[model samples]
Target: MRNITVEEFRASCAAAQQLEIVERKGMGHPDSICDAVMDNISVRLSEEYLQEFGEILHHNIDKCLLVAGEVTGIFGGGMVTHPMLLVIGDRATFSAEGKDIDVNSIAVDTAGRWFDENLRFVEPEFLDYQVELKPGSAELTDIFRRKEKMLGSNDTSAAVGYAPLSFTEKMVLDTEKYLNSPDFKEKYPESGEDIKVMGVRKDSDLDLTVAMPVVDRFLDSEEHYFRVKEDLTDAINTFIADYVEENKVSMDVTFSLNNLDMPGRGMNGIYTTVTGTSAEDADCGQVGRGNRVNGIIPLNRPVSSEAAAGKNPVSHVGKIYNALSHRIADRIYTAVPDVEEAYVWLLSDIGAPIDRPKVAAAQIIMKKGSVESVQDEVTEVIDRELENIGEFTMELARGMVPLY
Candidate 1:
């Protein structure tokens, strides 16, 4: 049995009449890069530990930082003055018996491989000169060592998730995915992976602000950059138009890319980077600064501040519960037609069983006068989802779920 609470609420994300804003930091954003690298490090550690010890060890490499690099570039060429600095930090059990796990090597190699696969403008050699690793503090490591088993949570934290994404939320998230998809890349080879999509919904008007990096190798001049931007804008607009028509939603949609522009400086004033990410010249990055577990940053929606990336899949409630909350909310919303919006909040105590959280709460805003009739059904869904929380670890380990 689970300690679960279900309640009906009048206010919900979908019922908000005011303007709503949603944001997505694409895969190549510096903060996203940090999140990806940390998650990869965790996965690599889990794999190696499983191979050696027959079970994953206790570790969490969620803390990381990416220091921006200095670079100068033009339309056709650029030079890097300083390489980006990556510092991977967190607690881990790397030593057992007479054997010591080379954690630094794992971290560096994972980051390099991620960059090679995701970043088009930056070479892997840049990471060879830039990345560093700092082990977790002795006190934190001691705390982890005190855990009774490998699957117990080592920290107390709360994770929040909501389901049935609003129209703008889905649009914003899918736009980023579409732009970064392999099909889009094939058509726009000069487009870099570092992309940010911001969607604003004001009644029937939808406004999108997109920031994308242009690879210098593929762009010969400022005109070429503008042309590519126009092409991208056209493609995105077509997609949005088709979506609106297909979904039977009425909205006036508009797009503006890279709003930082000067009067005299045209393309130069826009969002351009040598490495296809602002980390090359303007912005630094840190883990947990990017997307939430559900992907979109919905400013108007309730969200948890807990960072999910790189936490242990086995028992870290911060990671498991965040993903689980989303799953629960999604399930409830789908199973109960009366539920217009569902918000799930989970609280976990350190050293407690992973499946049985301290509190599992679900708040729902149902269709008018339908809450009383469907309360039992909604409660049943929540109870069923809570019962299956233990399966989240295997799903996460198998890469069936994404933390960001």
Candidate 2:
């Protein structure tokens, strides 16, 4: 608590600014796949550790690589000549008390399970697996065995988070979610899962460019593809209009789908894939290269480079502090009427208790009051979140929180 500090935020919020940009990679994006799969693997590994050892042993399993596969597609269907390779590499508690943990089996199995759940068309049979997990260093492993009430921090790391998504950020996120939603997919079955939303807002007008690849199996010809594309575009426009009016946003939005189109170029320029994901052939993915913990990649705001997914949920400050900071910032903005926006930063020292960070700071953009007026409320928010660190870690362990 001594390290906690709250102050007036001097910088202008991105929402109030004139020019802003935001991007959200859908769950089927190669990078998102890596992040989600590895994170799910960590969760499964944590559960196994809990069931076997009565506690989660030390591990940091964030490293992952997704190698692209070979495929050829025509107007009707596609063939996968080679499967995508998923290389999961990281540290884990392999042996404890002379008993070995089946880390590789858990990692490979979780990756398959994740693919089965997230991507509608992609299957584990289409993926190649490689697990490179090894036991963590003794120094880091000993942190979990400490006599302290809480597990000591695994590494000296810093994480920052901010509250209140910007208008462009929300629009990008919402657009991707809408396109990938089951209802939308049921109506437009050709749409691929590897969707990306890019939003550019200048003043009140916003331009949204979406990349949604179509599954080749659903298309009969180029003409049919164009017709479906037009229908999808019109449908998205209708959704955006409803979204704008429902949210009471005065901003004018223009939406575009799949900018890469050359009608006469055969299938050379068309964004079509075999599976619902580009991972079948077009692209590759890696952990931490996708979305941030908050889900949207905010380019204008302060961001932490540390990736939360796949990290040990117990003592990895990278995962815990990044998520907790957002929770703290959101709580402060919601609880204090005078606060317009809030940003929280947390820095940890190795071997220190997870609840007590070396620097727990909050920056508030006040609407009507000075720093002293809402200091107690803001500090209480941070203190309360830190005090409940155990419950928060359990949620992370159980995969209840979103890391990407």
Candidate 3:
């Protein structure tokens, strides 16, 4: 202590940290706004209402929650007014009968912040809002009426869980934790380079494949999963732009690999088909099968539509879904490899800007490996399924349901 000097003491002082203002916009659709309002009111009002009446208006209350999910559009809700406030994750504060209540500040099941730095898995666009309760306008009946009009349905039960691996599912489970863990990232880096090798068994009878960009080096689960996925996409796009040459095949490379352990199980027989027309051909032989056929299924599933009046549907599905599934599988392939029994599915719908084409859905299932084979086996199969998205597209362009 006696030997300490001014410069030495100055060096030992802790550095100051800057506060970050994480801003989010509002979902513009009335359905989304209504859902946010209902979810906020649920926990805050449920027990309080139950205490006054033998049972709360549970049915009406439940509808509010469902309507919130149907909203698909969002817009900027100005800036977040309060930057320093800490809004707990699950449990939110709300007003009832002109009185504000903090029901169980320590509610472990619902309250507390979601400790993730990146919340993309929740598709924050669907959840974040700056709602101000209108005077005399917070009644449950009003919300129901508004939702029915905006969502175009009072029966929304059928709309729930129709697909797999939605952003919402990613939030409510431990998958987010596994994705954000450094160990997970270190083991499954986006770039294939610097791969953490897991010894493969020669006797393993599963088609396990991992697809994504390979990094020059490896990093692990220190960051969130969606964040990693986004970063990986950006890096790969940059690589393609810089390294890929013109004319020789400037391929937009997406990785998908398939293997069949139980090749004779008939499970391997499920194939994707695409239907499309050449801008020049009125009648072509490739009606159901796409030109770029991979795996075993080469036959095109004929889908008579504007996009494929004389073209093939199978080939179209193969290219689009194959790419989409590979990318989608890359997201959850590690956590749940055996996707078949895990309820593996992918739902792709169309959106605006028809020329650019967006991935309306890309999802998969994951369960405990003990009940299934290699997690990658299911991952590979899903990738194979996606290779036939064009079949679905042709049907959509023709106003027909492609697949259930």
TM-scores for every candidate against the unseen true structure? 0.92, 0.98, 0.22
Sort by TM-score, best first: what order?
A: 2, 1, 3
- lDDT tens digits, residue span 1-404, model 3: 01100100111101111111111111211222222233333433445544543222222221221112221111111122221111212212244446554433422122122212222122223233222222222342233233221211111110001123221121112222332346645654432211111111122111112232222113222233234455644543443344334323323333212121223332122110110001011111112222111111111111111111111111222222433333333433444444321222222222211112222222332233342344334444344433444344334223232110
TM-score, predicted candidate 3 vs. hidden true structure: 0.22
- Report the backbone clash tally of model 2: 0
Per-residue C-alpha lDDT of model 2 across residues 96-160, encoded as one tens digit per residue: 87888889998988888888887877766689998888888878888888767888898899989
Best by TM-score: 2
Measured with C-alpha atoms, the lDDT of residue 77 in candidate 3 is: 12
Sort by lDDT, top down from the best: 2, 1, 3
Q: Which ranges of candidate 2 are over 4 A from the true structure?
A: none
In candidate 1, how many clashes are counted?
A: 0
Candidate 3: worst 10 consecutive residues by lDDT? Answer: 272-281
Q: Residue-pair clashes per candidate, as listed? A: 0, 0, 47
Model 1 scores what on Cα lDDT? 0.79
- Per-residue error for 76 in candidate 2, Å, reads 1.7
